[model samples]
Target: MTVMTTHLESETAEIKRRRDPFLIILWLVLVVFALLWVAPIVLIAFTALKSNAEIMATNAFTPPETVAWSNFSGAWERGNFATTFQNSVIITVIKVPLGLMFSAMAAYALARIKLRFGKLLLLFFLFGAMIPFQVMLAPIFTLVNGFGLIDTYPGVILPYLAFGVPYQVFILHGFFKAVPKELSEAALIDGASHLTVFRRIFLPISLPVLAALLILDFVSTWNEFAMALVLLQDRNMWTLPLGLMSFQGQFSTDYGQLNAAIAMTVFPAVVVYMIFQRYFVSGLTSGAVKG
Candidate 1:
């Protein structure tokens, strides 16, 4: 017993020695990475507070004489953010939930439930992720025009759903495969339908992948510029990304207001990630472990 105690003590000391430096190194790396990420946001925050003259005359890196708190308001009004923001919200609100439900359900059906063409359909969707949206622009434009969705919210929302579904389904299908068959089998044994099992078992277990995919979809749809620019011709139908173009002039542009507009645009995506970040890592890992 005395020999065992001494051996255990030595083992504990050795572990401490190994762990301390590794932890220090990890923390240092994290701090450096965090600084790199925060630097741009800090620059944007400071730049957004400066006057246009200040941004032009002085180096962009220079701090402003006074923080122009009104820059946000100026950009908001000049950019007509109210209208564009409403359009984005309308698209996001209507798009994200529907996209999530459809994709998750499709993934569950493909991964869990039996289907004849499951592999072929999944391959088709996975193939879409490789296809650039730009490549399909002309055809998609013609289709939207034929459907009379031009310059309308449905125009953008529909395309967003189309693009979002394939990728999200790909993610969710993998996660659903990771879920223990026992859970679904047990539920079915108790007379639960596929829909009931999906809601209770798969949905709860799949939260992480859901959160991560939701964030990805939200950010992509929020920042979508090319499709919005093409589909939406009316100023009233413009989303924030399209409306940011309003700040440009023939020869000169308001750098301060542009930066302010950008900061506003970035804020929501950041907030969304922050809210769902806790689930992101777990979701990614859980899918892998289960599989």
Candidate 2:
């Protein structure tokens, strides 16, 4: 009877410990931070739905008196979003896959092959990634101009591909290295070529990382502004970021419409992240502590 009573008391104490006050406090702090983080997005959403007059009259946190659905239509038409959005899609479509293909091939070589100066080669690639894109802008523009490719998709795409490759290679290299050696070896022993092994074995296991990179690279390519601005002079060729800038300028006085344009600009990336966020999180952590 004493033992049973003691066990009951011990369980009660454990339950109390589990519900520690510090843990509750920590959760409350986290909740506050989460609200803080989401506040700007909430504000933007509210502002997008409001009219210019209402926005001016009320505080930023106030709900709109009436939702202005026309703001989106106005933004779309005035912003030339149809043309700019198409351009961005074309650039991202062409750039991301080519970049990933090249990066994957380079990473596969680095991971599976025993090349002389392999580490040096990797450092060289990493070094390129470390260099600021701003630093390369002048040279990139000059090169594109020399090619007579200004305002062309190729002009914008080439730079994006070049800038995208190094970081992608670094990520893929880590992922490829983490994959089991035995799988590749077994495939090789079955008379598979290096290309076959890479295509059949490595690529299959690397889907999470690839999906993560797909969304990330898509966002980067989609949001790229400086290089696109430098390379593309034609308004028709302007990507969404540039078009958004034009939209903002055109509707500078109209906060509702401007915010609507801002919302439209961010929507695609947000959707992409929402769709692939599971893979993104897993891919980032997969190679961090290789078992």
Candidate 3:
């Protein structure tokens, strides 16, 4: 009976020991922030369900009178999402891999090869990264027109590749430099070329950084609007952002349809984040250890 009583007292102490007030407070704070973050999304979802008249007639926080799901299908059709979505997918699919490959190659050379003036060249790329994209629009437009790429896929794609490479190379260079030199030297002694070393040694270890860059580039290219607006003139060639412009009339806007379109357009990037979120922190940090 004494042993049982002692065991009960020990269990109660253990339970109290496991509880921390600061941890509970921290969690409560996090919960508040999380709710604050999700509140916008929830509001947008509710707004998407409302009619245009209902939206203007009621309070912003009011529950939508009806869950008008047709807004999605209507927006899909009226916005011509089929073609715009296709263009975005093609651009993302081609650009992500192409950017990564080229960036990785350039980064490897800059980080590992000891090329003459490599720092100057990296400075050039960093300059490109720092430049205001809006300032480049006129020159880029002229170049695109001069090359006869106006309203074409090449027009849109080339700019993405050019801008995409610098930041990617910047991040990847740090990562490549962080890789131990002896490993590559060992590979070379075993009859491996630089190409083989890159493929077999460097890339395998650099997956997290690469994944983070991939997600970042994918989201940026997918959501790009200003450049797309200037380059693409034909309605048929319009990407998702341009297609959303169709919902805005000079006088009035289709708020329900507009909100629905936004949700759909944002869905892919959100899904990509969810998939790669685990790798993101490690990827961004591990590359910086040696840099």
Q: List model 3 lDDT by residue over 1-291, tens digit each.
A: 211222235777768745846556766877999999988898788888998888898887788998888888888888888999998888889988898999998888888877789999988887777776877898899999999998999898999999988888888888888777898998888888888888888889889899998889989999999999899989888888788776554212777887888888988999998999899888988765445
List the candidate numbers ranked by lDDT, top first: 2, 3, 1
Alpha carbon deviation, residue 57, candidate 3 (Å): 7.6
**Number of the top lDDT candidate:** 2
**Model 1 weakest lDDT span, ten residues long:** 1-10
lDDT of each: 0.82, 0.87, 0.84
The local distance difference test score of model 2 is 0.87
Over 52-99, each residue of candidate 1 has an lDDT whose tens digit, in order, gives 778778776788998887888988888888999989889988999899
Model 1 segments beyond 4 Å from truth? 1-37, 53-59, 249-252, 288-291
Q: What's the alpha carbon RMSD for model 2?
A: 5.8
Tens digits of per-residue lDDT, candidate 2, 172-273, equal 898898777888898788888999888988888888889888888999998988998889999999999999988777778888888998999899999988
State each candidate's clash count.
Answer: 0, 0, 0
